[model samples]
Target: MTLPDGGQSPDALRSGTGGGSWDGERSGRGLSEREPFDLLVTGGRVIDPASGRDEIAAVGIRAGSIAYVGPVPDRAAAYSRRTIDATGQVVAPGFIDLHSHAQTISGGRLQALDGVTTALELEGGALPVADHYRYAEDQGRVINFGMSASWSSARMCVLDQAPAVRPQDDPRFRLPLAMFDQFQNGPRWQSAADDAQESKIVGLVERQIAAGAIGIGVLQGYAPGSRLSEQHLLGRLAEQVGQPLFVHARSMAPAGPGNAVDAAHELIDTAELTGAHVHLCHLNSTSGRRADRVTTDWATAQRSGLRLTAEAYPFHAGSTVIGAAFLDPEVLARDGISTRSVIYLATGERVADADRLLELRETDPGALCILETFDLDDPQQLALLLTAVTFGDAAIASDAMPLTYTGPAPRSGTDHSERALAALTGDVWPLPDGLIAHLRTSGCFARALRWLVRDLGVLDLVEVIRRCTILPATILAAAAPAMQRKGRLSVGADADLTIFDPDRVQPAGDYTRLAPSIGFSHVIVAGTPVVDGGDLVPDAFPGRAIRGSAG
Candidate 1:
């Protein structure tokens, strides 16, 4: 519930057992009740993709779920409630970000401001699942989130004891066997890997699932052949538990042998062997046929009745740690790629000379690099591919990184993070185009959807909304038992509708290679307006964590 000033209380909350909350709900000890729904949004084209309803409608919200959805209710006469005019607007279920590196679902607020109602965290899922639930409840969040287990994430916690964890080698992956092998055997503490490593890995993942992770996320790209057995085991366990696998298969760039096809099929093989659901992360990152092959394989498996799905972001270049092999001509040429095709991102120094890259790779393997591989194309073609691949089953993944917000603000002048500092002694830099094309400059959801509906002409309003809403809601519900009231535009669905001027809703994505970070206007979450017009309302963290199956 919302506090008087349109925020959640800082006090601890606890929900009782059976149909219990993902996190506990606090006793409304001292505060007066909120006005049920803060406002009523009416006169808009309401599109609930989950159920496929597209028409002019009115939505009533109370305690965060749609109190009514169809005919407009009296506003001035209906007690004390605010009224929102939605003429010429598009009212649809809020979006969902299927993949991200979130430690806790509470981090979903970043997405809510962008109209994302759900954020699913990947890797290592929710170790100590209780804490993840608490973070969401404590925030009185506007959006919802789900957990995914990461083999790499689990290893860092139960095994190493850190708040954060990534793959052994640069998990974001740049390819090359020498670099890839580290994830498999792991650089010994010389030899015997404590013998308990495998057990710990399994136990950690199992616990994350038990805690609340709905699925597994393997950045197979970085782990290479490292955790194959464990991943196979994870797949087995996920199947038994009915959780999907969110895999960042091998490599996305045209690098080495690890394009989307290679990594995805391998995971598919594991799915075949273990009997589980497998999802490919960021399908469009590769170019031309390689990207097509991934969707083809995914389709074949699904049609054959092997549960499989994939996710793709709207951006062209991907962001990973900045020290990957995209800089090495040897690696590039192998993929039929080149340096000119790669631009450095999240760093300040220019890329190193070929000789320097070899020197660095040999000397230091942990170096980071966020490369923007230039796979430039007609926006129309890009949208078409996304449409062809989604299969109406695919979900949208913002791939919106934490550093994008927590990283020094764009106006900070100079990068202050340690990673940025480290890359400086060497030549690394934030790609020029990234700061623009990524929608970092503005809100991103509309542009992402526009690519799907308008440019690609793949889907109309209904199907796209379904991908963002009911589809993700179903996924979240699979994780948290309390989320039955989420994702759809039903009477009981969470009142998380976004209302925007349809004509004015044209994409604001400034995707010219030089200006990626631009977006759109009007974002509402959980019956609350986190972004009015186009400004982020600070102190508005209304996100909730969604736990997974206990069975």
Candidate 2:
């Protein structure tokens, strides 16, 4: 990619009047008169997706906001607390994961290393939004966090069941996983809501939004008993509140009630009828071989002015609870997948037959199992799906799973403080086998960057950054204006950035051994260094909550 000017020199690119708004007064002696910056990043190829600026420039951060972005004059170097030489690196907005389930401390640490600064649960979101935020605040967070109000959780509450909440003393903080379990096997999962129950569920969702939920999360696949009328009601509620409705569509199978095409149709129809902005989660997994058609339909909806969008992970395999309604024998048969295709995450063993699959579902419904449905190993198919997402203007999200850990209670202070100390001292422990069994949880963005930009050469660096940053930011900012400050590098934007060597960045883990990606030189969150010199800053918790306008 050529710089906007005739030359590629840092001076030419920075001095030239291009995309970004330049502060001429702050360029020379004026910089010396201003307050010193908290941090200065110089000599990097700064790519701001929102402003369409991709060139070598210096960035100055002060008080957790971007203070300057332009050529660094000689005198400007004097006004900084710290300076980082970002030569041969790409400095862009830190990735924002819109569908992540990795809200725990360990999960945050791993995501930080992989260059994610913001991770939100938009699919199967938390119930009791206040409690979720309070728990995260009490425990401390390494990255910015937010969540939608879960319809599944509200349904459970309406049915008189305890909604999923991470026990305050539970070290792992796997409430999201527990929520999925509840949705999969609990009696309410297969019980349709009657007139009164539906009203209660809607009321609970309204309460959650009032408590600061980013939006409303609808996981229809796990709740087969839910009527289409229920979904429409939820859509109308979201529209009334001017918030997006994030949904895991009803099915992924090729035929029957779980067909991907039909599922897309239902979601699109809901959006059209209710005028709700709908976000389809995990298009690759939910749409399977028909993802292209779904993307086309989504495009048509967009042209029709229907508020619709979608997201997809890079991986081909998808994980879910064993007892999910969609996993019933008849449903599985319609999908043309058998038990032999299922791999247990806990033991790393494949389910041998239908009998064993049924046995596990009955015995341990909460255990996670991976289904190899997409054949992501085939580069061509992967590339095609990736192209579809890019063409469809869909954002890329990790859908990262939670990480588990076991250790003694913190010796002093809050749970977050102990974990921070452990991270700093190199004493933070991982689960015996691993926190998560899948590589996508830790390295989705890196893998996408490597395969899409470096290897396959299908997308340029700027385009990939746009999909990961500004695109998702724009989607969420419609409902939560606070997100407008994120996913950008313009002056006055939040100082959340990821610095990495483009040539060396790649994912290192796979199905067998989950590992963090490599080549993230530094990650800054809210103007604070969370990962300095490729190492996590112990006890650093600069993350703050991102709530919807309703809050």
Candidate 3:
């Protein structure tokens, strides 16, 4: 092992830093230099928010790890043997959507089309994250993907029923039994439900973590019965695992018992108390506080740094299942919400198939309230979007309207397919199909991004790209580790990249239910192009499940 002339022998040099780390598990030891690279993405804008670099750069890929990132100096330099001409296009890391239900429910191929490289399924919106992650990995997903252990889904899966009150607080757990007659009167359900709630849920979270869930998703609105203690428990578990907690506030209903502002404050305080990295989901809703009010509350909370962040869709309207729309109007009086603030996203005027709507209300109430007005006027949306274009890592999401369910062949007797489909997805407010279709199309994200580069003129292209790339990656890492490597286009970064002609690039927003946003040119994932020249390239899934190393 001794050096001959001051330097080690060639064999030693080659053996020391070139082996034993290909799998990347070395107890804090870094990777060596000789692993076979999987792919390389070269010649792109490389808007790396992490390194504060936004210029022409090349990324080297080896063994599925980024081996180098920086100006290539020369394409002939001693860097990557492989390269991609991302010149005149964006080479920043892939886009990450934090709470996208569409990610798994839509088969994820759709999200890949939208240039979303990493999709984090959260709360109750998607299937159990572990199962979905496994499916993705088996397919060798072309886009990076992760999941959060959904609190609502977790509890529901455990209890196999929803509660009416915050049951965790009561020592007896009797309050829910008294409040929800169904839980009380059901057939031998209470005891079984209780056991399922306590033991199965804990086991489920652990299993998801073992299966590579990045963090936990907490959607309180979806689990109205989840008490403060239940949320605290979820936070504690996530904190123990060093994962992020995605929170969709419980009472952000336009007609709810608490103002949206109050909900925001509540989340901030909960985060402060629980010591969890709290990501507030969907900043605007009819039940959300007024835009001006939310601005003040969010500013103050963010300044305090309760590890808080929020996401917003670019459109003027918000969408959800109709059952949420039918949340007791009396709650408006309790929460001091103004009914005028709410506008139906899907439901409008006459109820679609009155009988169907009634049945949906009783059994599967959350059919479709597709879109509605809540917070942030069009002007405010423009301001936020404009600001984000320049400042990277704002954590923006498409929040595209996605179908929740594709049920079995409709009964031959069914007339309105949309209504029947809506029932399957939990839509109760069945409105006209033509009435609220805009919120579901690509025009939403395009229009939002457009207001920035064109009308507002707030940010240059570099800054806008950074926000979408690096900034979001950083924010997501604050909550989930999978997003950390995803937002960069440098050496050792993932090969997920997007290249589009700036001049020719345009948002193709056509509100057709049949096909939406089907055009994206050259979507490269993991150093492979999935979409070329605005068309899908088959047999091109290069994605994989990203594991969280923090825990």
Candidate 4:
């Protein structure tokens, strides 16, 4: 029998290696004379980035692991179980999101329609990693999920004395939108940590890592006035634990001491000094119009043997809470960010002036807003954004924000006190109208395929698939070896696959009407098909937890 990578030799007719069971954690059983194949996908072009093979093939699955991939002569008759006729589709490894904040069942459903099988919260991760995992397990996710150890969450837990629990745990608890907004006027956001306080914060993060956080999430950009010494210490901690530090660099000012360029250097310097794997998050919006220079600097550093990587979403605008440190009037003025460029999602109001912006910041510091950083119509600005998206081997992450319903809380089956956390992690399906989130939540991958490969011709389909799969999996391989089994289609790899029509796969979501992207025929997680024939399987929950080795 032939193997998954087109029978091991250049010719598909030749048989090089036989299929057998591997990786007991994910696989079910070995191929045997008595057992029948569980599922067979036939008549499609299989693109396996890990093996560098792209050809027409059939994939056989048994017990959640791929058992065989070759030219199936008998098609359905060879396998008595389930069969998928992917006649006009491309079967590729399911997209892996390296940075996502949509950790709810509703969010997972939206992402599944966009061809994602795994979505990780590495940029703004969760605190008390164990609790996060427990909650997700109890709720049952639609796709494989994980998170990093949130440094900002740990900081607030220590410095601001914020309650580190959901509203379910305490009557007075509230879900802070971002780091500095944990408290309306808290001084801890701007103050440096004392030696003891820094040690305490480090201990909290370390404990969470041991509890199964994939890495450390450094959201220093939200608290730009905070000291750098704490970040240096965190870098050292990540190196010691062999986990990468997912960093949102401090400050996005245009041309000052704490500009994006300086922040890029700081990350590179920290990687060099501490010997840690530092991941720069959201290079597109964070680097603003200077993406060309920032990407060049990072590429040079990477060539110099520094352990650094970056991710960027395709959109020119960014979504965050209104109280971000960079949204200060002076900083915005220096960067030429007009007040009109920012739109409040709750009220659908564009800030008329600096006074209105400050009033909103003071009154509803945790409100969500969208910042238009670039005009796609302008060729120069569009090219600047593309510079980051097309950077050498950079992963394309969604940076998907949490879904929110601006309407009043439901009167039945919902407690007034538990409204915030409930909506954040609820199983609300068929999301109600007036739900507000960035279009990236449901359209990032489809949009990337549409814009980068088909429209602009900047990259090929195979290269974009690599960025979505193997590259992101390789980035986290050191911390979570389980990822090595994901992001590819091979004999022993987990049966997580995305099958779609190249011409038809297009993002349907927009600012006014937020709809799920269409065109994925099937999305398999592990061995089960969560999306079958372009429809969601209501009962399929085959997602598994991805955790750090320290756990």
Candidate 5:
């Protein structure tokens, strides 16, 4: 829709028309020799959503930023150390995930394979901001990473309850099974904050923001008992710091107090009252068939100067901890779903009734379950809801859950001993079949590209790229300065790019089998190739911390 200024237009960029000539002198080239470049990507259909550029071009990188983007120079081969021939591929800015929960190494690697270069946990951020960043850095992330200050985690921390996970709590920096379980069946999920507890929660939030959180992650849905006043206070704190408030709204029920519409209004009203920028996570899952109505409300809020945005994944069924209170029979009835619709990620079996749900909750409190809340079985209804969110300009996010290993460990003296040793020491192992049971963790972005752009044709290629790149970047840049130079293909922008075969790019996995997508030929993060020729580059850790202004 709105093209970014000072960037090439789609036609000009694609067709190489009506732009400056190849100015070698201006690009630091001498008469006899071209300036050396660290990497050169040649002969690709460069689609820069920010500039509306979609032309064949060559890109040059120096250090970790784009140094040149234009016609390939005659001496380019001689001046560059690495060259990737990108013919027949679409070279675009790497996708930026706004609400990813894939913070672990296995998760990050999966995201890289999906063409993501920057993945942030904004929906439910980490408790200790410093530790979240430090752990990712110390453990060697495969993509740029960051997080917001989690109001939910802060509330649990102040209550002195053991959270499902804590930032850097483990020596190996692993996501604890405790974190996912705590939100479902504990006091943290059931209790409402009083005056003293509310004040302490607010204090923790402020401290986290001061420690470099990009914004405040408010997951009120997990704790329905949390008072609106407590949320309002969190909004005020975010507003005071000029940071956005990323929220997973209170409920997904179709009727009653905690319905999706009421949940949206809660955040909209809070943002209006506190002047805080608020982003709703996973609107498709939360609002279901009523997503269009919710989008209308968000648009109305924006008209009134309430800064509101929302995101959605491509899938219809949404996953969460099995023991979440919202899964209670009364709530599920209000939401119009049943236990029969509940699919357990660990077993891939649909819970047959209340008895089965209770059995799973009692036996496996930490297991993740998928609720078939939307019209996933109907193609037309699915397309309509998907189109509604994209029509509203909602950004795409995976809400990717972390992949965990529960199988037997590798033997000490086997041929796979090295792999076993790494797994033992690194707190990670090959993802079990159950871990990749859902496509959301590994195929969300690619699925969005396939379903929205290639299949339904709801959006053109450039528009989809904009939503995944510049749109999310623009939203975060208001609070996180580190994002300003990202999500674009202009000179001086970070050399994070995803080169894929647009014709072949599609999600490969489904509810039955989990697999990574194909066609992502190259994924570059900060000038280093993390995924080369459709395979992950072993031991590559070019990702850096994306801190906020507070840091």
Candidate 6:
């Protein structure tokens, strides 16, 4: 894993041109001398997938945007007030996560360590989109954050008679994940909406878009009983508004209309019927062992010009609430998922039998759990898991879950909701003890680089960078114009960039432990260093809202 130039020092590289000292006082003749840049990064292999640049270069930031990107003199710091030595590292556009659910301050810190600058909750988005943004702005997020308008949230409000907005003091009101508890077993979960209810849900989603939601988040899997007519209506709405529908396709049951392939068709068919752009969320976990077949079908459809896109994470396991409809024994057995594969996060215990799984789901439906969908140790199973990830043009997104602390008591029922709610709104950094979440929250991007690029050699550095950066930016840029300036290293683009040692960047945690990744030298958001020199800047809050044009 030697870097370009055989691990030589930055000074050695500079000496080739007989440059000045490494202290960075000398300026290159090619550089401009108008105003000093706010920040500068030197001696890194700059890879901009958007443009085909993969060479040693320097980047200068000014006023929250990229001011310069070119060769620098030995004294690169002469161009900026603050400088970062990115020698032996890769400087690329900051990773964009299209499926993150970890919207809290502590959660964003963990993601920053993994090289992510923008993390959006597009799969299970919030109900009152404006409220979600307002709360995030008030709290001052560490990384950029945004969300879609949630179809599930709208349905619950209409069918379950739930309030559209709760009091400001109630932290659960703004956190979309809390809906898994507050309305987990509500009638909306298993009931199909009538004509009037469907019209009302459509109205609510439209209002959310007008409030600046980037798109529509359809958690179709949670409400498996939802009628196709409702999906058609929603797709039409998204098409009319020129926005995409981020959908979690229905259950992965092995047979019937709810099977994985059928679920894929549900989205494709809607797109064809309504001309709506559809973005599939977590194709790897939802497709299970059929990832290869599903990915191939998607590729074929993409060739035919249906407005479709997808994303995948590197891990074989997935995290979700215990009561997800797809986790039922009948559905699991049909899809080859055994009860033993499910592990309760509170107790860190594998479900012993169907009885235990049912009991847990009944008692604590909102509790978080991990399900190993593929046996990564087995070569054949591992290949199937990689199929979706390596598929052409697919973004690498972390379906990162929110963090929760299970105190010593580990209470169920109302107590569990209280603990989960507290974890979502807590401002404590360095995360209090007993907090646990899926490793993907902190390691998704690093693991993708380690396994897919370095270890397996399945993808090259530039290609992976394309998937992590520009591809996602392209997917949303049509609706959110601000994204047009992100995911690129050219001058005038946003200065949200990630610099990391490619040779050493890897996941620092496993199934049994949770820790932030290592080897990330710096992570900048809007020209501010949120993670600098491999450490989080405690008070940095440069994250800003990313909204759609409909507002």
lDDT per residue as tens, model 1, 332-440: 5666554444433334334556665555556544433344543346665555455434644776666654322224534444545544433211222332222222342
Where does the lowest 10-residue lDDT sum fall in candidate 1? Answer: 173-182
Model 3: ten consecutive residues of lowest lDDT? 173-182
RMSD values for the candidates in order, in angstroms, are 9.3, 5.8, 9.8, 4.6, 4.5, 7.0
lDDT of each: 0.54, 0.78, 0.51, 0.80, 0.76, 0.83
lDDT of 2: 0.78
Q: Model 6, 1-551: lDDT tens per residue?
A: 21221122435435532122222322334454557889989889999887677888888888998767777666666667888888899999999999998988888999999999999988888877887798889888999988898889898888888776642558665566666467787755457989889999999999999999989999898898899999999999999999899999886654555678889988989998999999998988888777877888888888899999999999899999998888887778878788999999988899999999999988988888999988988998899888888888889999998875655654566454445445556666655556788999999999999889999999988888899998999899877777877887766578899999998999887766778998898999999999989999989999988888686
The regions of model 2 sitting more than 4 angstroms off are 1-22, 25-29, 163-166, 169-174, 377-384, 404-433
* Candidate 4: segments with Cα more than 4 A from true spot: 1-33, 166-185, 408-424
- Comparing candidate 3 with candidate 5, which one achieves the higher lDDT? 5
Score residue 277 of candidate 5 by CA lDDT.
87
| Cα error, candidate 6, residue 32 (Å) | 3.7
* Tens-digit per-residue lDDT, 1-551, candidate 2: 22221112334335543222344323533365457889989899999878778888888888998877878656546879889989899999989999888777777888888899999988988876787788888777888999998888888767747655654644333454455565456666456888878888888888889988988989888886788888888899999999999999888877665478889999999999999999999888888777777788888989999999888887778777778777766677778887777887767778987788888889888777778776667876675576455666788898887543223445666566466434421326442333344677789899878988898787888888998998898898768877877898866678999999999998877776767789999999999998999888877989888898898
TM-score of each: 0.74, 0.89, 0.70, 0.91, 0.90, 0.91
- What does candidate 5's lDDT look like per residue over 1-551, in tens digits? 12343233444423434222234313433322355778889889999877767888888887898867877666667868888999999999999999877776777788888999999988878766777677678878889989888787677676647443544665433542234445445555456978888998899888888989889888788778889999899888888889888888888776766678888899999998998889898888877766767778888988887888878887878888787777876678777788888888766788888888888887777677788876757886676577555857688889887653333455556435444334422534443343443578788888878888898787888888888898888888768876877898866678999999988988887776667788899999999999999998867889888877765
Give the total clashing residue pairs for model 2: 0
Best by TM-score: 6
Tens digits of per-residue lDDT, candidate 3, 1-551, equal 32321222335433544222322321212322343335444566666555566666655566554555544444322334544566676665666666555433233445565666666555332224444555445535546666665444445445655442332333222111112222322222222234336556656665666656666666566455545655666667766777767776766543334656666677777777887777766665422435455556666777786667666655555555544523445554465544443433333433334344444446644444443343345666445433322322345665554443333444566445556554322223322233223333333333434555555666555655555566556665544544545666544456676665554444553333423343345666766767666666656667666655542
Ranking by TM-score: 6, 4, 5, 2, 1, 3
- The local lDDT score (0 to 100) that residue 23 gets in candidate 5 is 47
